[model samples]
Target: MKPSTSSFNEVKKAIVLLSGGLDSATVLAIATAQGYECHTMSFDYGQRHRSELDAAVRIAEQFHAKTHRVMQMNMNAIGGSALTDMDIAVPTGGLSETVPITYVPARNTVFLSYALALAEVVGALDIFIGVNAVDYSGYPDCRPEYIAAFETMANLATQAALEGHKVKIQTPLIHLSKAEIIQQGVALGVDYAKTVSCYQANSEGLACGQCDSCLLRKQGFREAGLDDPTPYAI
Candidate 1:
């Protein structure tokens, strides 16, 4: 027997910002399991880590996203942050004051600008991003207020929103600790091996295990009592 037409029509579609990191991968799985036709979008923003992008591609393929678009937004022009700057060093130790060097200036702004464009083209009202405040890197854009402000901006900026179709920026992993995020993702059957969170992975994707990203990821997995799935020499 054929599936019901209503059933097919009822699938909620989402545009997910997948970065091939643990948080984003888990977000995609959650969206898929929740019945969203997830369309993933990643960017080659000239960051030090291409491994994360590669991992994103694998994660997108794992879910078989309706479509995956990797956009190239050049932020190499602005060398304000560590990820983009050769001079600055990625900080160690627990989360620090106001912001970290890894905090690219308006990184989320650049990313969300693209996500919004794609969402408009695809007519998807929901956008899933894996930005968290609990295990955050102190970027101002990672906060809930920032997201809310962006949502409001989206409502005003988009023609569809003006015409009554509103969009939602869903950060499911927001406000959750790294360990808690890991636990949730695992419970949701997210195979995190496909995700990469190292700030200093080599060309061959070997994680440095000392960068802030790697350290946090290690702590999270350890706290969760789960072995690290990333293929890194740590």
Candidate 2:
């Protein structure tokens, strides 16, 4: 769903793909702090970890986003990952070198398509996505090469490009490790407590404390020398 652009102004506008996770929340805070009128988008893509949606709203509000939009998508129907398919149990094991089951098929592609459409609607030239390669979950879509390819495709696919207004896909967190991301967010006064990273958080938004996401988040906080503020369902 597209949000009202009533708050959009002369300041530069940026479309942020916010997943309500720690990285995305930090990206939103970073974009807003950089003086962009942030238009945040979150997806209700039929994932088992739907609790993150609520956290997205909270983070958006906290950063004073120009608009916060939640788009309902039926990725469950095309599920290939454990996140959208209930039959495939979420892995509690540690991260692996290969692509994990939690990597939703073409999720970032679909997400970026929506963001591109919204950017055209609101005249935004910049789109920010929180896809990190370092300390990532081994998702193919999280790589910097993938983001660059998508950006190139977006520029060619949109009418805005014909008019000489190129769309830039900005992955500010792409190279940063989780610890570095947390440090950046801390410097920007981001409230990490409101973010959720568990692959299967409960309805109350408590982390399972076992999934890959939760483990990564825990490690990040520990490495950053900060307390983990997430509530766990353990």
Candidate 3:
């Protein structure tokens, strides 16, 4: 459903980080459901699966976001992760306790910094991100403590916050399992088929069905008792 149209002065604006993944798509739905004039942002930071960038565009249109911006940067220059560096292989093995090699260095931090800037310019007090500590690969930046720390820094670092406006970093999926996240998204009428969650998605946005991301997404659909509409290359 589309967010209700309101006058600019009465609009409740929010900047949503849309990665063209299941979680980010769900977060966009949540922000829309909350009656926010959503401005979605996606990054094309030299990721191997550039198909997700296309997916991001589709998702923003599907959700009827007020605005969608794609920022281009070269994270591959400092790449230690398999996602940004084609040389490093995506792990098909099961999840691990330690941080995986798939983790992009300071990715959320960089994304949030950009979001904070956009929020200031758009007069959006809330910045929505779909970071989950539960049902995720071991990414340090996805933790609750990290989000909290960043929110504190955002308030201190922004001109909007200096003028008595507080910036909130909203992570609605932070505490929810993948199953719960899927359920929420389905309830909000999110089209899972439009989202690409696989770390090594093909040019057509088809999942590899072997990477850590694909495994988690599969499990989430199974647990949610929903048929996964994600197109798989396997």
* Top lDDT hit: 3
**TM-score of model number 2:** 0.95
Query: Taking the tens digit of each residue's C-alpha lDDT, what string does model 2 give over 1-234?
Result: 333343233458999999999999999989998889999999999999678999999999999998999999999999888999999999987887789999999999999999999998887889999999899899999898999899999989976776677889999999898999999999999998899988999999999999899899999999999998899988
TM-score, per-candidate, Cα-based:
0.92, 0.95, 0.96
Q: Model 3, range 1-234, lDDT digits (tens) per residue?
A: 212222223678999999999999999999999999999999999899788888889999998999999999999999999998999999998887799999999999999999998888777889999999989998999999999999999999966677677889999999999999999999999999999999999999999998999999999999999999999998
Q: Which stretches of candidate 2 lie over 4 Å from their true place?
A: 1-9
| Model 3 clashing residue pairs (backbone) | none
The TM-score obtained by model 3 is 0.96
- Cα shift from native, residue 147, model 3 (Å): 0.6
Which candidate has the highest TM-score of all? 3
lDDT per residue for candidate 1 within 104-161, as digits (tens), equals 8888888887888777666778999999988867778989999999999998997667
Q: What is the C-alpha RMSD of each candidate to the true structure, in Å?
A: 4.3, 2.8, 3.8
